[model samples]
Target: MSTDSFDPVLLEILGNKFASVTEEMCLTLQRTGRTLYVKETADFACALAGRDGRFFAYPRSIGVSGFVGLECLPAIEAAVAACGALEPGDVILTNDPYRSTGLATHLPDLHMIEPYFDGGEIVAYGWCFVHCSDVGGRVASSISPVNTEIFQEGLRIPPVKLMRRGEMSPEVKLFLDANSRTPEANMGDIRAMLASLATGRRRVAQMLSQHGAAELGAAQGALMDYAAGKAEAVLRTVPEGSYRFADYLDDDAASRLPVRLAVTVTIGGGKVHLDFTGSDPQVATAMNIPSCGRPHAWLTLRMLALVQTLDRSAPLNAGLLRPLSIYTPPGSLVNPEEPAATGVRHAAAIRVNDILNGAFGLALPSVLPAAASGTVIPIVMSEPLASGGRMVQVIEPLIGGTGARQGHDGVDGRDSGISNLANNPVETVEAELGVEVLRYGLRPDSGGAGQWRGGCGMELSFRILSPGSHVLGRGMERLLFRPWGQAGGQPGLPGSLVVNEGQPRERRLGKIDVLEVEAGDIVTFRTPGAGGWGNPLDREAEAVLVDVEAGFVTPDHAKAAYGVALIDGRIDAETTARLRAAQTGSEGTVFGPERDAWDSIFAPEAMDRLNAALLALPLSRRQARRREIFETVLADLPSAFPKSPANAAQAEAAQRRLETCLAETS
Candidate 1:
């Protein structure tokens, strides 16, 4: 192999080879791993990193796909600083978000790093992570969105060695065993992670033996450089301008106030800048993102997606982030200080994804798609057993659909825009938990209507078989503000949780902390749908009839949204022609009636100004000031102000109150 200016053919070959090594390592872990998160959800990933501690070869087919851009340098440095130089046989382990500088985003994700030795020197590093079972804390599964600090989330393991000099550290094992509710399961996953690292080490040694050490080093650098060039080339295609957008999470689980994430993307000089200065200050909840600023993976995922979509051949590595720069204000949601609970960081990340997509859509309207369902909730059930302890397992990791792009419909019941996680099989979920799976199917007529329709959402219903069973659903979102559409498209419907549906005792829940139910109780979860693209009137009449016949679009929606009449699973062309001729299309993008109502009271420009002002104040006073402002407006409105639409008179009164507060504050 050529060391200097290696052949392009060889570079591609080597890139594939290295990436395959990571995949093989992942396969090894999945085969040996002992957890549903690994065998079912595929929550683990393995990668080969350069000496600089940045990934050069990341598995594209398996594991958490968004973490490819994360840098391992901080975690490696922290480990070395704490435990001297890493030897060939030693492996460092950590799940501390702050200590590893965001290498491990949350406590449940155990990260392991192993050094590959060749000729008495470190050639590359092997990195992998798994979202293991319960880490003992305030609740089972060790995650609660209402947890105020990291301490309440779970045990935070800093950068320490689980293995030293090829031997498992007994002290680390003792601590791990003591601090977890499922010690055997957690250790089983840990051992699987170690096996993955060993696989990577052996693979790296073989590659080094075949290609020579210097050639391997040169290949790593070349792969990154190649990816960097590709990323820069794609970024240069985005129109040179600054576009600003802001989005909101329904609320921090502990409070009614919505959490805001604002961004401004400036694309120029063949590079992009993401300025998150106007985002809300860190919340006192687990939703806070511990990005540690510095263009972290969670913060830069959209940019990476944009580039990859434009150029699919671009290598998946940290180098794709070379042309991007980021600014996250200190103490902000995106860059929270240490000890902030980050158990539910993904909830914020989906909003950040929307904000970035909205902002970039302004600059590259044709290239970007509309907002997706913008929600991912993992529904878990823990039931008391006949013998002892609780039998806990995730029923399903529920998610909604992807947004529609120009000239194409959004994908239904699948959204890989953020994390590409597979849904758990009903058979597997039923075998593990004390529940009877009743309904697991798509929610018909849920996708927003457009020329190219948005994707439909999912619905899951189950019946409890055991008494004293508890259901936990975390990271639930899109319950309030609907997923907005683009270019005259309509927003999708909001999600909901219902208990004992079709019964008198049924209750509609927007968000859940924890709900306890006895035997015979039934629970249902319906996720929101993605946003559409273009005017619904522009959709072909035949297409509307097909959708109606297929049960995807109702006959009523066909006539109302698409201006096409359908009768008895057939198109009524004459009535459709009359309806189309009489109907008037909406102008530009539509964010549904609910968002419009909220925007009337708290307009975008006014909210931007308010957020800037709140950010300028002291961190301790920001939340208080924001609450005061919102509460004053909400004082006169209904209890479910935005979720349940207000009357015209009530909206006007709320608008006046909001304006008065903004005037005084700004």
Candidate 2:
């Protein structure tokens, strides 16, 4: 049977069945999983993949939402080539990003694939991955942004059978147990994954019994084709032209210099091509994205978001990526070479999503929203136990608000731009770990000011109750450049970390490696707010008053940002009218004061030329040479150069010095 002969109604039914199977698998994994990251934060995902290795059915409301496009074929092929053809009840496991052809993105994300057989022939594969607590690395949780190579990140499990012929492989289990800091917890999650795969296998067999093998195979292709058509229709709505945009990570964890990500999206004839040509070279830190030059999930997540946003009923599968093509420059941040650490690749992916969002927004201004709070920090705590061991668990998955759109305000204290992870409840955190939750709530006046106000950021303050405890806040970003606003809207506030709120012993820090703390030390994490849409003066005074009442925007902020005066909890229309008349509004994307100052010295054109020259050199020399040029140019400026804008004479000298450096490189 071919897709042409398959009935539409049957295809829809099969699509629902396939989706439900994956969701059931997810539920099983979550219900039986051990770690806080798995059970509470839901950093795991389950999907059904076709024989070609691409996912045909993915869960909608569970697990990580951005990995629908991941390919499982490479790992499948690698396992088959190494250990011969797969038999019944064989499960292939791997966590090596490079070895698995980008299937397993990082060390902690343990990916497994189990072949489902019908009449002694393989029909579909069940796939699932969990972000394990530890895989044995230099740091406590096996992920540190400062790690320069993949070997230091964690244990690299190749594509081998963790379970063969319905029996667990003791050799593989032994190696896994020896390599992880949380061996018992890892095994518990592994068992949960096995249960998920078994659940998927049973569901596939039930579907086969109902629809027969031939019709089931045909429905897989037919459903994908339907989704592809819907995605193409959405792409056609976008204007036929090239839209270019770029954004930055605050800095590589090893250095203070920022990392750049550039993208040029071309949409024409119901197809989109993303060219990541001007992105910076792969960094020496763990912040590199391991895309392997394919249209990886990390590189093209925004396109998935766009199609889903336009066509709500489109099926969740690899077909959504059919109309998209990507070109990530070799050795660039998006396509790092082998052995480059990818422990925190999601940090770079968050910025990649921003650039893609910005480029697409240029084409569909009314459809796409302003920038989101571009950060996701998984604040983890490692407390000492009485048995001379350490207890490691995630405290909270911190994130800010989503960007405001043309007609709708952004969602406050919740941004799913990257991973849609749920925060650990305050009571759960206190119960699981040795900490007192001081405050967990939204920050007032954190969102950008506009007609449709941006979402406010979150604040988490806690005091350590255990002596000699350590805190790990990985993926911290948006400290320098704010989340940019659109259509003359103001930029959002940047993120900050404070050791203590109002004490002389307070010590403010940027992105940390591994922070050591003692009992009574209070730690606070404030995430960046999202960018707003349209001019603030155009926002209704009543809307500002409502925001003030809800504690999202303070009374003084309402007057300052939106030009609305609140008197006795009521909007003063007369005062608001005067303030609006006096206030001036700017047009186009507003990148706030910090970006404005940085752009004055290191302009886009200059950076492009510099990167082009640097990319021409050997990979080993790119990072060092690039660092030298920046250091020489910034020698005469203040220590905090970009944070504090340079003087007129200083800016001129820096620009001239940059020109000379580029000329010499040429």
Best by TM-score: 2
Question: Each model's TM-score?
Answer: 0.96, 0.98
lDDT tens digits, residues 1-666, model 2? 989778888888899999999999999999999988999999999998877777888988898766533442345455445556888899989888888878878899998999999988999889999999999999988999999999998889988899999999999999999987789999999999999999999999999999888888888888888888999999999999999998889899888788999999999999999999989999999999888888888888889889999999998888888988889889999999988999889989999999999999999999899999999999989888898768889999999999999999999999888878988888889999999999999989999899999999999999999999999999999999999999987778999999987998999999998999999999999999999999999998889988999999999999889999988988888999999999998789999887888789899989889888988889999999999999988888888868888999999999999999999887
C-alpha lDDT of all candidate models, in order: 0.84, 0.90
Deviation of model 1 at 247, angstroms: 1.3
The number of clashing residue pairs in each candidate reads 1, 0
lDDT by residue for model 1 (549-661), tens: 77778888888889998777778889988998998777566787767767777777777788778777887787788888988988987787676778889888888888898
Clashing pairs in 1: 488-588
Q: How accurate is candidate 2 locally (lDDT)?
A: 0.90
Predicted candidate 2, C-alpha RMSD: 1.2
Once fitted onto the true fold, the runs of candidate 2 whose alpha carbons sit more than 4 angstroms away are 68-83
**Model 1 stretches astray by more than 4 angstroms:** 1-4, 68-76, 644-656, 659-666
